[model samples]
Target: MTDPLLTTAELTAFLARDFEQVKDDFTVDEITAQGIKLRLNVAERHLRPGGTVSGPAMFGLADVGAYLAILSRIGLEALTVTTNCSIDFMRKPIAGKDVICDVRLLKLGRQLAVCDALVFSDGDDRPVARASLTYSIPPK
Candidate 1:
């Protein structure tokens, strides 16, 4: 297996510098040959009226997790944009719990990267959502 192009510290710094809007919300938990694991700290803003984490919040975590997973292999291609995404909400996420996303890279090619992310509420064994994402890699 090829070595990762970016380390977790490097990715964290890149996100902190470039994507400050979400930098504090996410943490890079691990990087593996297949992909990366990320956590999203849940806040009141991420919850809905029914005391459940909102779907959009979970979607954002999956998207970011997939993006960083691709970047771990392809380097800091900020322009690498999501081309398509399909997310399934498996269950209602616990409102106060953090979300953890485990992303797996299914394919990495010259022009596109395909990945899937499983999102879970922290301390829960079951997944709350699953997302399949496709990202378009920018030309060199």
Candidate 2:
């Protein structure tokens, strides 16, 4: 059977305010037993010329989603740091759409976590970017 997911309220409280990025820009729209749904609040700063979301902005979404996934499983371990990340920009994103990131834990170990993220522009079904990330969680 699949493991149960930790709620966003639990995660936010666990971080003790250090994870402001998640608080400020993202909402835990859904957390099923399998994974999570992270919604990004897009703004003008996230856009590039010709009205596409900037690559860096997409990268940030992926990165933060990974972090949130780790925290969801591990609790508010603010010291967990990104050790590696690989991102693929699959396609240009539509500016008006809110970016939704789906994050799943590939492996959750005692001292580390690996997550995969698929990011999509809100209205469409296709992914705009994909990322795999590893985070180091300090031993308590």
Candidate 3:
């Protein structure tokens, strides 16, 4: 198979340029043929009342992770937008730890890319949440 269009550094810069809101909180950990791994540095803002990572924080991790996975293959097509997302929070995330999401591209077609993501509390083997997302790829 051919190599990905974007390197980790390029994707990271794209995030900083186009998605400033999340650029600092998230990071690219690894990219391979099967998928990409992203980490969300769980800060105080990500915590809920009970000191657990909030649902929205986890969703953001999944969303960004999946989006980056698609971009890894297709390059920085900034207009590729999420058209659908379904996420399930299975358990509370560990307090004071970062969250990691591994994303697998289910399909990469002409107009759309679909991804599956699993979010884990850093250092844990079990996933705390899982997400399925579909993004609309912009026309060239």
Candidate 4:
């Protein structure tokens, strides 16, 4: 396995500097050979009328987690964009708890990277959502 090109601190800093709007919403918990672990701190804004975490909120976490996982291996490519994403909302996420996303990079090629993310509510062993993402890496 190859060493990660970006550390959690570096990825956090990059998000803060480039994506300030969501900088506070996400925390990079760890980066490993498999992929990255991210936490989404739940807030009032992320809740739904049903007293559960909203789907869009979870989707955002999955997307960001996948992006960071790819960047960890390929280095920061700001222009790298999601080419496709398919997500399944398996279960409703608990409110008032942080959502954790375990992202795995399944494949990385010259022009694209494929990843999968499993999102779980804090303290829960079951996944609430699953996402498969493909990103187009910008040409150097």
Candidate 5:
């Protein structure tokens, strides 16, 4: 398979013009041929009572990661929107650590893309969660 856009600079530029929340909530830390790295600034709203990252917060990270992965390969296509997401909370994520997602696109076709995420706490390689996402791409 051909490589996608593999640089933080490119990811950020794509996000700025298309995905505004990427500027507000996430940092495109790294991008590579295998996948991409995404960091979430976990704040109070992103925490549960036990000082763990909330489900919605992790969901957002995974969702955005998948979206970015698609854009990385296909270029800026803002109309691509999530159609479905199934997430598994594998472990309790540390509260303060930035949530990271390593996302890979499983399928990229004419009208749809499927992707998955292995989410982790900063400094931890083990995944705290896994999510499979489907996005609908607008007709070009």
Candidate 6:
């Protein structure tokens, strides 16, 4: 795979600039040869009534993770938007722990991108959720 167009620091800065509302909740962990690792810094608002992470929160994690991975490869393009997301919540997240998503870009084309993310509670071997996503990329 080619080196990413955006580094972790560059992606972080882009998030801060474009997605200020959620910028504080996520961190770019690392850019691996395979994909990008994103961490969701869980806070009180992210928990559900049963002390598990909310479905919407996990969805956000997966969505943002996928978005960042695509941006890493394609550069910080704000016009790239999620076209579809199908997610499965398989297990409850561990309370008091942050969540991590390992994001992989399945395909990247001039006009579209496909990706997926496996969500796990910090320190867990099993995934709590998984998501497959597609994004529409602006033409070059």
Best of the candidates, lDDT = 4
Residue 90 in model 1: shift from native, Å?
0.8
Clashes of 1: 0
Model 2, residue 99: what's the lDDT?
95
Candidate 3's C-alpha lDDT? 0.91
For every candidate, C-alpha RMSD to the true structure in Å: 1.0, 2.1, 1.1, 0.8, 1.8, 0.9
Model 2 misplaced regions, further than 4 Å: 1-5, 12-16
Where does candidate 1 stray beyond 4 Å? none
lDDT of 6: 0.92
Against the true structure, candidate 4 has what lDDT? Answer: 0.94
At residue 91, give the lDDT of candidate 2: 93
TM values, all candidates: 0.96, 0.88, 0.96, 0.97, 0.89, 0.97
List model 2 lDDT by residue over 1-140, tens digit each.
Answer: 14645787776565446765546667777765646778887888788998888888888888888887777766667788999999999998886888999988888888878888999999899999999999999999
Candidate 1 residue pairs in clash (backbone atoms < 3 Å) = none
Q: State the lDDT at 123 in candidate 3.
A: 98
| True-vs-predicted CA distance for residue 86, candidate 6, Å | 0.2
Candidate 4 residue spans exceeding 4 A from truth? none
Model 4, 1-140: lDDT tens per residue?
Answer: 35799899999999999999999999999997799999998888999998798999999999999999999988989999999999999998877789999999998888999999999999998999999999999998
Per-residue lDDT over 1-140 for candidate 1, one digit per residue giving the tens place of the 0 to 100 score: 34689999999999999999989999999998899999998888888898888899999999999999999998999999999999999999876789999999999999999998999999998999999999999999
Instruction: Name the better of 4 and 6 by lDDT.
Output: 4
lDDT of all predictions = 0.93, 0.80, 0.91, 0.94, 0.85, 0.92
Across 49-99, the per-residue lDDT of candidate 6 in tens digits comes to 978889999999999999999889888888999999999999999999999
RMSD of 3: 1.1
As a whole number from 0 to 100, the lDDT of residue 76 in candidate 6 is: 80
Candidate 3 residue runs with Cα over 4 Å from true position: none
Model 1 score (lDDT): 0.93
